[model samples]
Target: MGEKDKAYVEIYDTTLRDGTQAEDVNLSVEDKIQVALKLDELGIDYIEGGWPGSNPKDVQFFREIRNYHLGWAKIAAFGSTHMAKYRAEEDPNLRALIEAQTPVITIFGKTWDVHVRDALRITLERNLELIRDSLAYLRPHAERLFYDAEHFFDGFKANSDYALATLKKAIEGGADCLVLCDTNGGTLPQEIAEIIKEVRSRLGKDISLGIHAHNDSDTAVANSLMAVSVGARHVQGTINGFGERCGNANLCSIIPGLVLKMGFKCKAGEPERLRRLTEVSRFVFEIANLPHNKYLPYVGRSAFAHKGGVHVSAVSRNPETYEHIRPELVGNSQRILISDLAGKSNVLYKARQFGISLSAEDPVVKEIVVRLKERENEGYQYEAAEASFELLMRRIVEGRKETFGFFDLISFRVLDVKRLEDERSLVEATVRLKVRGEEEHTAAVGNGPVNALDNAVRKALLAFYPELADMELEDYKVRVLAGEPGTAAKVRVLIQSKDGEDRWGTVGVSHDIIEASWQALVDAIIYKLLKSRRKRLEAA
Candidate 1:
């Protein structure tokens, strides 16, 4: 079937408005504009900029975003109904929505009687009038005006007649679409389906309907899908599910659920745009300065990572055996994790990934698996340290006995000098290594023992390998393993290194923290040297 022939649903993203309400999620005006541009590239139907009346940052965003042209999305300004003390036309909040000059305007109003009585502290009749007046005042200025019936599900349950009455007021006020919001996020999928059905029955199918859900109950995605099944044509959510409390519906999960699983269509569901989903998801997290949630469905690093031997074996033959859909469809790739759970199949699969062809029956593969499990039992984690694992496999495959062929560690020492009169401690490290069978000795001083050791080692290797100049230590992490040793427990060190073009991870474990760090650091240097040599060979 053609794209035009499928049932179409509108994807309205409020990441800038509602998503920023999340704790620890704060975006500048420029960040908001960049996110809107990204959403436009993803083919979103509407991008809620923010409440211009609420903050100067949002107002600045609405101004700056006007300078750029969006390919697909229409900009929306979000706000609440005007206060009861002022007429809608005379209200500053309503005026700000009009002044934003956006093609779309969304205003939310109290739907639950409890909110009207307790929150708004206004009569139910007055709240209804505010909903009607605010939307009506902004209707002509906006190309599209959407009404959000806040707490609609709870409102319907509290007073079905009043909740249904709120919809009537919005319709009378010239709303282009009425979005039913599960504000408290306590509604279930079954409840969403039943409530939407009842709304459709009473309000008829002529009026446009949308669903806005929160994830307090962890059912925002499911509730959004359920609302779609019950005739909601518009779906509202935020990227990565960011919001005030638990979060709004996650567009990352909802988009694929609607298109791939349910056979519905939207602009983002198009093949080309869908492939950018993972990139877009990571980009937002980067801009937010937050760590990406690796377990997020469809767009996470661990989403399709196979760890179990049996599962990896099955998926190697056919991805459908383990994956619900092809990872490439969402621009993500399958991953094979190596650990104690790894089998011969896992070893062969990883070898292939590293461009080393190996058969399932290879004795070297069996040896590698055995050694890997033994290392893991000793607190070594290869899942995040693939470079170290690859080096181990190469050594086993080649039948080499030395720890590393590039260099050999003879001995190293660190000393700290402190005085009672001085508040700071001076640290120094000395390293001796044989590079190409030639012994090289170096010494260096640094802020700490690890830094001094790293500097000394690099100084020692720089004379033999000029390419080591470009290599940098990106991140270092240490974890103490649980054991009966108390403060003397074994520690694992994971080091991340990058050489401008490529990055790799290596790990080492020992009872001494410095020794563990040195082991990882040595693995990192060896990996870099080997990678540079491979590239040079390939070029030749």
Candidate 2:
């Protein structure tokens, strides 16, 4: 599309400000600054840093951010309108906005008549003056001024004339753009489009427009897109939909929809960096110490995973038959899961992923498929435990290349002890193993049986392989198999391990939790050793 023909929309990211309101999300000053740099690199138009007066951490963020140079995104400080009793210039919140020294200023004001009367305990006319004076006071301090009309859609529904009046005052006060906010997030897409159209008509075509939506109804992304369709030029959202309750619109989904689907132009929506959306999404979650939702649209683990027999076959033949867009476009790849419902294509795809040279016609492909189906039937899930699947494929394709004879397990034992005088109990474990031609023995006590076993096993190997000290189990999960023995059912164990620079997963299944944990633990150590050996060889 030509530059003139392409629809241009401003991409404003509120992940740092609004996203922190999520129940478990809290970013330190350093974390917020680091995220801002990443967003700047991704070409986001505006980065809403935080409410400076709300907390000391936000104040420090603005101070620290001034020391660095952002390439593309202009930093915006977010706050509300002036207080009811104070002048715009005298209000601490407005003064903090100036103190932040950001090029962009975003302030929200009451657009709903109910908020004016009930929340502020002020008359409707006074609320209009607050919106006007707040924007006018900050307009000279910022290169760009944005006004968020809080509850614009809901207010328009209840009192259309009053909502229109607030937008006019903001325009009269010199707001560069007026953003309609669906704060309650209850408005439908059709309602949003119509309201924005009425706004455009009443406000005239010369005024700039934007949309800010929440995801309570699971339609924030859709509502933002619908508003854009009706001549709204700017879109506001948080990464991964992080926000107060449900969330704000997800910029990860909204940006792609605008640029790739709607033929719009966003600097951050450039095709190359846009492909990094998945990486950017996960990075935010990591900084916030939050678990990523693997089911999110376009960037999730399950977004492109193909599982069923017919679906895998069709996806292999033509991905478009079942897939929406190419997974590579958003930094995700096609994943063919190995399960009871899998077929030859799943096995072949997995082999290719591990760099194993195999073809559909290879008889070993059929063998691998059968073996995977059998293991899956025995309550092994290789989807989340990809390291185990890779090991299984390598053993079948390369004939036990991973078994490097690092060490051989002899036996292990666990003991649980309790004292009648105290309420606490203790567990201890001992492990015996052989390295080359000698036997080594070690024992350790821990809070639980599994913890003691981990310590004991690592104790035995740390002498010969000091690198083993760097490897620790990051997570462990177990699931009980149905249709097995009722209370004494078979269980599957998934172990996630991490070294200094890398993480991997391994799995095991058995009726005994201890045995199952041992199996997975052994596989994890073996994989780490094999990886270390491969890296040395490649360097040589």
On TM-score, the candidate that comes out on top is: 2
Off by over 4 Å in 2: 1-5, 339-540
lDDT of each: 0.88, 0.86
Q: After superposition, which runs of candidate 1 have C-alpha atoms over 4 Å from their true positions?
A: 1-5, 339-540
Residue 359 in model 1: shift from native, Å? 23
Per-residue lDDT over 377-433 for candidate 2, one digit per residue giving the tens place of the 0 to 100 score: 787766446678888887887777444578888889999989875677789999998
Whole-structure CA lDDT of model 1: 0.88
Clashes of 2: 0
Clashing pairs in 2: none
Model 1 pairs in collision: none
Task: List per-candidate RMSD values in Å.
Answer: 8.1, 6.7
Q: 285-313 in candidate 1: lDDT tens per residue? A: 75575656989999987898898999989
List the candidates' TM-scores in order. 0.65, 0.67
Lowest summed lDDT over 10 consecutive residues: which window, candidate 1?
A: 338-347
Sequence-dependent TM-score of model 1: 0.65
